[model samples]
Target chain A: MLLQAHSPRGLGSLLLMCALGLYLALVASISLGPMDISFSDSMRALLPKQSFLPSELAPHIEVIIRQVRLPRTLLAIAIGAILALCGTVMQSLFRNPLADPGIIGVSAGASLGAALSIVLFGSLAQHYPEVLLFATVPVCAFIGGALTTVLVYRLGSGPNGTSVTMMLLAGVALSALAGAGLGLLNYYADDQALRDLSLWTMGSLAGASWPGLALAYASLLVLGVLFYRHAKSLNALLLGEAEARHLGVNVQSLKRFCILLTAAGVGICVALSGMIGFVGLIVPHLGRMLCGPNHQRLLPLAALLGALLLLLADMGARTLIAPLDMPVGIVTAILGAPFFIVLLIKQRGRIS
Target chain B: MSIAIQTHQLSVSIGSKQLLKPTSVALQSGQLTVLLGPNGAGKSTLLKAMIGELRASGKVEVFGQTQKSWRSERLARHLAVLPQSSELTFPFSVREVVELGALPLSVSKLQLDDIVDKNLALTDVSHLQLRPYPMLSGGEKQRVHFARVLTQLAQAGEQAILLLDEPTSALDLAHQHNTLKLAKLQAEQGACVVAVIHDLNLAAQYADRILLLERGNLVADGSPWEVLSERRIEAVYGYPITVMPHPRADYPLLVSA
Candidate 1:
């Protein structure tokens, strides 16, 4: 007996531990930076318990912690949660562990949408200085993402219902189409627009702002609760679409709802942090290995693990080359790809 | 006996090819009906059509109500299907897999657990309850699915219909008999049990009634002694077979001649 499947009571303890670990990672991410703020100072700066605490240090710490690091840390948690939760749902919906939003062209579609907004609306931003550019990009991205998802789903479905293989093929074709659109936008861009496009595509927490942070967190909470309630249905889906139907799950509606919601969530995350890859793919597998394949336990744990990993990755990006921030996407890919490969090799015996 | 399922001119077709011809039949409660046919003979197609999984040309009713009229959730409570193979991607334990059968029910947690536990033991999979479904042997996996479908019908009352598609295809001799015995036991308890099976001997021994299909047509429907005759078996199956009485059992025994 592997004895690896934890009891419900054991899973509760594991969740509590992961929650504590996530909190510690959040604290560490806020405190340690190029400025070398002490852990206590970071906490104090975050929560101002004393009004008069060494005025010079207080103001410096306050500026760094509040204006810069605080928003970044919170955005990391929200985006990470969104990506991982969506990944869990996508994997179950598609009936493949390898599935992620990227597999279905949502990320590519969002990137195309963002590229369009940045290149097309560049002049508009200057003329309409009062208009917030943040709102425009995400709205456009959401539209693009939703359109691509609907297209893929339509192409994949025929008289026999949704075909996972057809969906994958359609996704690849759409990703290529979006890539062409991005290339065209790249060609039409000026130097500044080109630079911004590159940075956004590479992905960074450097763009984190208070408003963006608030939007990301709000989406996270709402989507998290909704996805959590659907955990059992997702589990039934793992038994295949027909089996799920036999078990009284509304297979067609569940597939439609999950796909659209994931598209929306991934669209917002891409708009806020750009194209961060592999966090969605990697964290859900880790959650499964830790807590078994029960989605009731898997989804929440995946969210926590995703948040912790991304926060740590962002921290490494911030400090590894101090004063020159690396794109957090690179860190996630570097960390995620190797772990994914090792898992593939380990499961190779059963691959057939 | 009350009719558990009644099909009026139900037929299935794909493109221009008719898989099952228009056929009318009534399956009664307190009986186990086994569907026997050669490959591509429309046995599975008719079973799927009866459960409304496939679109048929005519009507199917469960307990005097149209199959289409019942909500899927409510219908699921009265009818359970064990497909030939269930595609599972995750590592669900046998108990968890069994517990999924209670999804459509509004039963309390204790009642649900009792149903799952009872079905698990009924299928003789109680010892394997903690084992991962994917890790089980082919026969064990079949039994786990058997437990799942059985649990699904636990609350469906006397008029319930259970459809099994090749429920013993992967099982060994002992397990095959054990599974059919459980199906018969369900019928004895007043649930209408139907199975599509390939084994002639098993069908002869277990089925209260046998339905023999040949190339999209029902050629025979009667008791085992009436349907499993040597001449008809050879004609429908296109192979020579020997039919003899079992020495210690009250059923016919079949052997290839």
Candidate 2:
């Protein structure tokens, strides 16, 4: 019985731990903000508060807590989850651990799209004058992400099938093209458009709103669940194609489904948040190290860890400079780059 | 009962190079058939063609149905194959890999686990269930794959056919015997087992019938004594060899000439 438990029990416990970790992280994210609100005050603000508040409680704090931090935190969680899920799927699709949403040129494409929107549409100053810059950026970002993915898929796939190497190389080529396009757009942009484009390129959750939050979070959850159901197929695919086929998996269909789901998830994430690098690459690897490579465990665990990592990074971005805020993307890169280096160093000896 | 597999004048070419010439073979139910050939003899190609992994110019019938006539998923429910080399990129446990074999069954986890456990125990790999597949030794991985193949065979109902491409290449002597014995047991249980074997001795020891291929052509097909004679082995394998009785069994064992 103990042996059987070791074989099966560990997986269940690990899943429970990931769930608990995600829940605690969510609570922490909702509680922490620039206002230094206590857990109780945060909870009170979260719920519909009646007339029992203190007289010194500013009306703006309620608005800030409800409208700003809540939506931002929720968006952070959703975007993080989507990035991690996409990373896991992409890694499997390419059969390379280095593969990520960025490797597929989605980030560059989205960035260029956002940059073009900034240059061509005269920034958020001209369009949606009432809304902040953050809210409008996601619209252009998503369109950019989707269009780039479609282009990359078409350019990379042959009549026979999509080659992982071809996709990676195509992504690199397109990324350079998009980067050049972005540079040209930046060179020609007005001062305000340039500033907005630069900040968008840097990535910030400051633009998160209730509508954007609802769309990103809902799609992330839905797609995350769908990818979770695909865990078994992904696991079978760890074996080569012939072996996977013998195991009764429809390899081509699974590949297409995984690719599309990954594209949609990553597209939404890039649209919502500029280019949050390494979360996709690092989170899935860490999850695999902790929970083994069973995607049933890896997917959910990676999602939780990615959300927690991003939320923590966002908190650092907000609090590190006191009143001034840095881009959350910079914070993730600062943290994730070193960790990625260490991972590479550790894997250096084993990689053949 | 219907024939499990029938290949009629099957021919395969890869980039102007003929890998397998026009050949015809019929695999019947409840027999452990061995495909004997040296390296680069196109045995694997023929097996892949039968499994629809490669395009062939001839007709293939699976359980009395044309290969093209049966849907892929439906064909999967009746036939399973273990290719020559399969490397896992991820760290899936042995149990997880074996459970994948039940994918065709479309059964629940409980049912899949039951089948996986049964196959694991049958292949003597139950103890390695929780171990990562890549961490296992070469022979252990072979057994694990055998267990996976067995799980697929079990879930594939009656009239199921199995194609194996050198299933014991990485296995040691004991494991090789055990693996082939298990495949023989599967055959006795009414499944057709067609395996490509390099070791003529193992073929003579276990095969109900042997098909000899020489340079993409079927040179001979019959019982071990008829197909594995000294002259025939020398002529097909293009090597000097001697055929002698096995120490423990009456089957002919090939020795270096």
Candidate 3:
């Protein structure tokens, strides 16, 4: 029965199906927008025209597709994937399903940095355009996210190294500190700066650009691949530190590697999308439900499902309210919160 | 293949508290060597030192090589340890848990499956293979952990060194015997087995030699008859114990004095 459950063909088929679904979802996402480009026109827009291209399918449409919407959609996918990957790594690192990138203050720290950029560096906004202004936010956010993670790790690690409980506590403390900093920034901001900071905190894909998408997606994919390769080692870690060491895993080194990878992944996602909540928490849980807990299967499945969910959420954010544009984070919270509650209720007996 | 595990003047101090005093002991190859002691006797500490899990003042040599000289993966390939408590955070299946034993072998999937199956059968946990490991009773979990250690031993072949710290604490009487019987069999097959046991009767039944520890010091080492004497058991455990000849074997059975 165990053999049947772990059949390579079965896993391969499931992965293939998920990959096909993601591809279909990506194409469908590209078909969606404020402009009503039909599926045929969208396909034609992607390729060279048989006849002379119409002015409607002009260079501007190409720019919108290639530069604007494509990057934004890709950012959604990358951010979603990175967030979910971080969730998986964090949960295993802490050995608790309750752990997520946000739990460790990475997102909150990044948000604080972005908030500070908006509030104190608001003058840069007039000097530079929207793209340049937004660029500074991610850079600052990355520094804040990475620094907070290092602090949490340092505080958590003992003489032997970090205990799971210590790490969890450190994360909570760091998150609270970040939240306090964010509150201070919010209180002192001018009206326009306050509005901009609020929007950034609420989270959106509107600021997604080619450079931003490139930075987010590239880091996420590389780290995600590295994580996927360490799936077996992660499984060894589930046995706890001593047993993992007995199994030839360098437990301390693996913990450090996981922390660095999770920090990078979470940092990039928060930088790109401005703290989209629940994707990191929910998607990995969903993956665990479907794939069981062998990370070899869980990591990739979680990445795909995460990307799909966020893409769908982004679509709803745009289409549900039309031109008004609800925040993508708000959309995810609305959809994800109830589902998370149900998961909690169902697993309440087992969870500590 | 002879397996000698020798701790040379080993000492462990944790934060100004001496957990294990400087002590030297040798466990001969192909013998069921039992470490007997009271609570806080540093039996577990000494075991950890032997496995290189804890940093110590002196050296542990596996066969003739210093433990530090052996790469961790290479050391794991030959040595298997069952810690006193294994707290699993994730709900891995019994099979997944057992498969970890073959990690040092870097076995192919087919070989890993075979090793897991055989070890599970040996530990009598084949029936529990599909069950969630964390959901099992303490005794059942201990059996599964034993299966994992056994799998590691089987993979390590003749050179395997099995180090178990109170492995039967959670088992029922029958299981306790069965588990020790499996250990004895492994030792007979030329693996060096060192087990920390509190039950003197079970130790008497299975062990080829016994080493008694008292307050982080080695107090006695000999055959069960030599170590399970009324005076020594009473002296170390601070309890009256009667040592009498077993009806079925040459070794002595220990009872309340």
Which candidate wins on lDDT?
A: 1
TM-score of chain B, candidates 1 onward in order: 0.97, 0.95, 0.94
Clashing pairs in 1: none
Off by over 4 Å in 2: A1-20, A35-40, A52-55, A103-105, A121-174, A349-352
Q: What is the per-residue lDDT of model 1 for residues A223-326, given as tens digits with 9 covering 90 to 100?
A: 89988888888888887777788888888899888887888888889888988888888889888877778888898899998898889899999988987889
Model 1 stretches astray by more than 4 angstroms? A1-9, A48-58, A126-132, A147-176, A346-352
Q: What lDDT does the true structure give each of the candidates?
A: 0.85, 0.79, 0.79
Winner of 2 and 3 under DockQ: 3
For DockQ, the strongest prediction is: 1
Q: After superposition, how far is residue B172 of candidate 2 from its true place, in Å?
A: 2.0
Best-first order by lDDT: 1, 3, 2
Give one digit per residue, the lDDT tens place, for model 3 in B1-257. 36478888999998998888998887777899999889999989999888877888998898789988988888888888886668674656788888877777867888788888988898888998977676788888888998898777666766778888898888889989988998898889888899999888999889998888888888888988788889888888889977888887788987786
DockQ of each: 0.56, 0.45, 0.46
TM-score top scorer: 1
Give the CA lDDT, 0 to 100, for residue A203 in model 1: 85
Model 1 chain B lowest lDDT segment of ten: B83-92
**Considering TM-score, which of the candidate structures 1 and 3 is the better prediction for this target?**
1
Error of 2 at A101 (Å): 1.8
Q: Estimate each model's TM-score.
A: 0.94, 0.89, 0.91
